[model samples]
Target: MDQTTLTRPEAETTTAAKPVILTGDRTTGPLHIGHYAGSLKNRLALQDTHTQFLLLADTQALTDNAHDIGKVRRNVLEVACDYLAVGIDPAKTTICLQSHLPALAELSMLYLNFVTVARLERNPTIKDEIRARGFGRDIPAGFLCYPAAQAADITAFKATVVPVGEDQAPLIEQCNEIARRVNAAAGREVLPEAQALIPEAGRLPGIDGRAKMSKSGGNAIPLSASEDEISRAVRAMFTDPEHLRVEQPGRVEGNVVFAYLDAFDAAKEDVAELKDHYRRGGLGDTVLKRRLEDILQALLAPIRARRAEVASDPAQVHRIISEGTQAAREVTEATKREVMDALGLFRL
Candidate 1:
């Protein structure tokens, strides 16, 4: 053996400050500014301190994108590219594909046994989704089982922490409920208790200032949007209708321009001044919108640069996801064995 062959404890610190956290986004379209501000950027910071698992949720996505299988398949790579572009270091965090995790699928099946339909029906998030989609009197079976699938995603890795927005708290609760039931039925606790890291950024609204941002809602400014596109989007952003006059006293408290400034601008004092000036009806919406454009451009430029670089070499991108899935596969498979034995689904 060569003298330089082994690197002993000279490698790296094994202890992480944060526990493993399971978090991800569904691939309906390109990740938007809202997603980046609300969660993606926080995830980047967590990679250094936490055992983070960033999943590209294609399976969960299929619940809605089922009709557009091509769209779902296409967005998988695009979403991975977006993640990488946004600084989700694959080296420090596991970037696995959700559909690749069979254990999660199995776990979902087992969890369904414990949850009553009434309970799933009563979930606030589910009810909101159903109403939003106008699924009155006709709900997809997969849509109903979404929370059960979510339990599998969280428990498969035995994740102790899950980063979720406030709206999704009920879903995480459902995951814990399934964990408790499955563990009690087995006469043992196998799943790690999971907690939520709700970032203070909260759920970002659309550029139109219409509640939550969504592709279907036609108001999202995607992470991969071109400079011209971003400019167009921001210029047209909904400002205080009362501030029709550039010299008119503008309200910044609920102004979409001010909200975006709060989320993206690092200079709080400057933003505060801008808000006050606008509130006094001295600052114009165009001026504020321009400042917002500058801030958003500053925020998205690097993401675009990185996305272009990774897009040029998609094979490397795919390889990273493949490696992550392989690593997650082993962990999930072992958990599935425990799950099957608990359910007496094992072979002699």
Candidate 2:
């Protein structure tokens, strides 16, 4: 037998495999340009290269919306529509509702025992969130324990790659800690390790130039926004303050219109020219904003049309989510079984 040419009975695993990627959006409302620059757009492209799972974090949403579940329920489809509108192909990406997966809830419960109240309190992500929500003094227990829930979302799918921004970096660290502690306690590496895939996303600002663009902040351009709406939002966008006059030298340094261009504008020369034109004076804020308007429309037109087409049959959009959730749970349940057995969670 020629060693080089020999073909054994058992074939070697030579096929290329894409690692699991878990990323999600809370069902607060429809995703927007921030979601595009921050996550959704990347998910659509990543689906081509990796096995991606896009979660509708309804369960996580409830951590804060426990008192107002109606908002969460209503926005579940809104979030799904946002995903579909952003070109997250359901065929290429798994779009799942988090609440539909019992394994996540079970895994969260088990992981909860591993994390301490002090540890949860020390979670920078949770702490900052608590402060932001004015829950510092009256924090809900569920809201505080969400890192455990997030860890469940991650490990339930055995996702190895999580796309996160800088602010959420601590959450990933917390997930890794859970994996480490659980593995040590169980004496087995049942849960897969996860890491962040920080893409070169120029952090997009809100219409008001607030540091972050968030739906809750009410400064977002929803992915499903109409062309007219997009135009209105863009026209209302904040630009250089000192650039009061058309001939005034605009400070492109902090101008959000230019920042949007920097994030969404694909043409390097065009963006550079626009930046120089604004910075050197003689360019009106209206002119720069209109340029951004046209540029944004070019990108969002197709998405808006597609969103309209899908919005007509919201039921179909939701069915896709339900189907993906079921398929995802088939895998999540298998992982949960292994995790449960590792933790000695037996039914006797």
User: Could you say which candidate leads in lDDT?
Assistant: 1
Give TM per candidate. Answer: 0.91, 0.90
Off by over 4 Å in 1: 1-18, 343-347
User: RMSD, model 1, all Cα superposed?
Assistant: 4.4
- Which parts of model 2 have CA positions greater than 4 angstroms off? 1-17
Task: Give Cα-based local distance difference scores for all models.
Answer: 0.81, 0.80
lDDT per residue for candidate 1 within 315-347, as digits (tens), equals 777877887787778778988898878766757
| lDDT tens digits, residue span 174-235, model 2 | 99999999999899898888998765755678898887788788899887777899889988
Q: Tell me the lDDT of model 1 at 29.
A: 82
Query: How many clashes (backbone atoms < 3 Å, residues ≥3 apart in a chain or on different chains) does model 1 have?
Result: 2
What pairs collide in candidate 2?
none
Candidate RMSDs in Å, in order, are: 4.4, 7.3
Candidate 1 TM-score, C-alpha based: 0.91
The per-residue C-alpha lDDT of model 1 at residue 244 equals 75
